[model samples]
Target: MPLWTIYHPANTYSDKDKQDFAKDITDFYTGFGLPAFYVVVLFTEMAEPAFFVGGRPASDTVRIVVEHLARHLDDPDMRRRSTERLNSIMVPYTRDRGLHWEFHTYESPRDLWMIAGLFPPGPGTEAEKAWARANKPLPY
Candidate 1:
């Protein structure tokens, strides 16, 4: 599972923008063989006064925290490529929009994750593909 938590000042994004951004993120994960349902994107809007940067309120800042439980990129090269791809994906949403943003990813053991009372199938497995196609957890 790739759980993405995005934080920005209120009114930074419209409903349509949020939906589109989430779809792009989900697509990125699905391309990697992860189940579509396993990619979760959450947008949190905060009041300007409640957000800060450099010891002062920053209304143009965005922060993303991501948790990866489905798999870990243990290879240095793979991690670099993944980061580059993700940054490119965010270019339009953040850099082009002039929003100062930063994101960090955390990896947890795959064994620690469960969906709908079932353990997710291994990467690239037929069972995993079924879950991806269904967009939900299913007995495998």
Candidate 2:
């Protein structure tokens, strides 16, 4: 499972912007073969004052924290590809404002996460594959 969290200042983005960000993020992860039901994204708006970068109140910036099955950390190429795509998707929203941002992927082992009372089958596993196949309204 992959869960993406976006933390940005309130005025930094419009409602539609947040909507697109979530959709784009889910698409990015699902491209890796994960099912849509397993891709969770959240947009958390915070007051600019609530965030600080280098001890200075953040004025123009975005922060993305992604949590996924620890197994994903085993692939260096995937990380590189994902980061590149993240930059492309974010440039339109960050560049014009001269904003700074970082996307950090943190590993959360399968056992550490649960979905609907069951642990994820773990990425790239047969169980995960079967679950994806059984699920509908997704990129089956």
Candidate 3:
């Protein structure tokens, strides 16, 4: 499972923009064969008074925190590739928009992950593939 939390200045993205960005994020992980339901995105908007950078108020900085449970990049090469993919997906919403943005990821053991009272299927397994196709949680 991958959970992404995005924080930005208020009005940085419209509801539709958030929807599209969430879709792109979901697609990014599902492309690696994870179940669609396993990808969760949360968007939080902060007012200028509430957001700061380097001790100064900021309205153009976006911060993201990602949690990975289902899978992790265990090597430098894999991590690089994953970062590149994320950059590609984010350019349209971040860099291209002239916003300062940063993101970091934390990986947890898969054994700690569950959905709908059931453990998620292992990566690339038939059960996982089924969940990917269904785009929802289903008992294996």
Candidate 4:
């Protein structure tokens, strides 16, 4: 599964904002062949005393850490397009907040992904294709 973690100061985002953010991100990932059920979004709030930037307390900073299978990040075009889409999601939330925002992505091995008691194959792989054929589910 893909794990998207947004880190910000506590109480910075309302519940509605978080929902919208998650929905937008899920839409983007689904377009890139991820199943909606397998994608996850998380918001982690840090208290003012715990939030920091440049080695000093900075509650205004917003940070995002995304973790996904390596297959998704292995293509240059996919990575570029995803970055742009992510920027679109963040702009509305971060604009004019006087906050510094950053996003970083990390890729883990596809074989490491385990869901529903099975090891799911990476996108566009022979194993994935076979599984899809057998399960008669969407190719994603």
Candidate 5:
């Protein structure tokens, strides 16, 4: 189960755009065996001039970083080559230049279940319960 929480400036995106973004995320997870239903997405919109860093407005700075990541999606060596490039692009705009951002990934079996009193769990509920029992930490 992959949960995505997106936070952006208010009015920056529309409802249709949000749905399309969700579809993209769902497709990405489903390709790895996790279906759309198992993915949770939350979009939080903030007003313009509402977010600031180091006393400077975050309008242009935030857009630049997001656009850069979106542009490197098709690179075959993205994970290896684009690592340093992203950091380099973000240096001049920020207060700190030495700070770097790195991406990491992992895969594991996930379990989902529902409680009888709270909500009735549908299909795959039993499997998730069993997996939860074996995993030690039950994630509802």
Candidate 6:
């Protein structure tokens, strides 16, 4: 269950880029046995120039860094390497020497029962309906 929420200044991602990103991330997680229903990715764009450390404008440098990090998401070593690279390059390159780029990751055991219970049982044989009815009231 990896939910990716990307936030960056506007005009950052092309439609092709967005599609590729969604496909890659969904495939990656599902490959590891997480069902498609449990994984989601959201992208948000901001239009105004952002402020970085030292009061420098983010437009000057954020795009390159964002692209670089996005591409590296598939790398096995990205967890360690990406952090180091971002901290080293961004702190010095941005207007604010102390400004930090933020990335958040989270995982949780998927509650398939919760998802299944959200909808009525699909058409099935009488036995199937009986089973579903019998099991439907356990407070899932």
Q: Go through the candidates in order and give each one's C-alpha lDDT.
A: 0.91, 0.74, 0.89, 0.76, 0.45, 0.46
Question: Which regions of candidate 2 deviate over 4 angstroms?
Answer: 122-127, 133-140
Cα deviation at 124, candidate 1, in Å, is 1.1
| Better lDDT candidate (3, 6) | 3
> Which RMSD values do the candidates have, in order?
0.9, 3.6, 1.1, 4.0, 11.4, 11.7
How well is each residue in 1-140 modelled by candidate 6, as lDDT tens digits?
34566665666567876776677666654454344544456776755555353676564334321322112254658767745643443343233533235653432322332344553222244533453446332232
- Please give, for residues 16-127, the per-residue lDDT of candidate 4 as tens digits: 9899888887787666555666668899999998987888998788999888763466589988987887777778788656667899888888777776666776676776
Candidate ranking (TM-score, best to worst): 1, 3, 4, 2, 6, 5
Per-prediction TM-score: 0.96, 0.79, 0.94, 0.79, 0.46, 0.47
In model 1, residue pairs whose N, Cα or C atoms come closer than 3 Å (at least 3 residues apart or on different chains), thus clashing, are: 1-70
Model 3: residues with Cα > 4 Å off, grouped in runs: none
Candidate 6 stretches greater than 4 Å from native: 50-54, 60-102, 107-140
Task: Give the worst 10-residue stretch by lDDT in candidate 4.
Answer: 131-140
Give lDDT tens digits, candidate 2, residues 1-140: 66778888788888888778777766876677777777777888889789888998987778988787625556889778767876787777677568888888787766777666677675677777777767533122
How far out, in Å, is residue 92 in model 2?
2.7
lDDT of 5 by residue, 30-118 (tens): 55433345555677665667856579655433332121111123465765564454344334423252322232322332233323322
- Residue pairs with backbone atoms closer than 3 Å in model 2 (clashes): none
lDDT winner: 1
Residue 96, model 6: lDDT of 59
- Model 6 RMSD in angstroms: 11.7
Q: Write the per-residue lDDT of candidate 1 for residues 1-140, one digit (tens) a residue.
A: 99999999999999999999999999999998888889899999999899998899999999998899998899999999988888787778898999999998899998988999998999889999999888898997
What C-alpha root-mean-square deviation, in Å, does candidate 5 show against the real structure?
11.4
Assess candidate 1 and give its TM-score to the true structure: 0.96
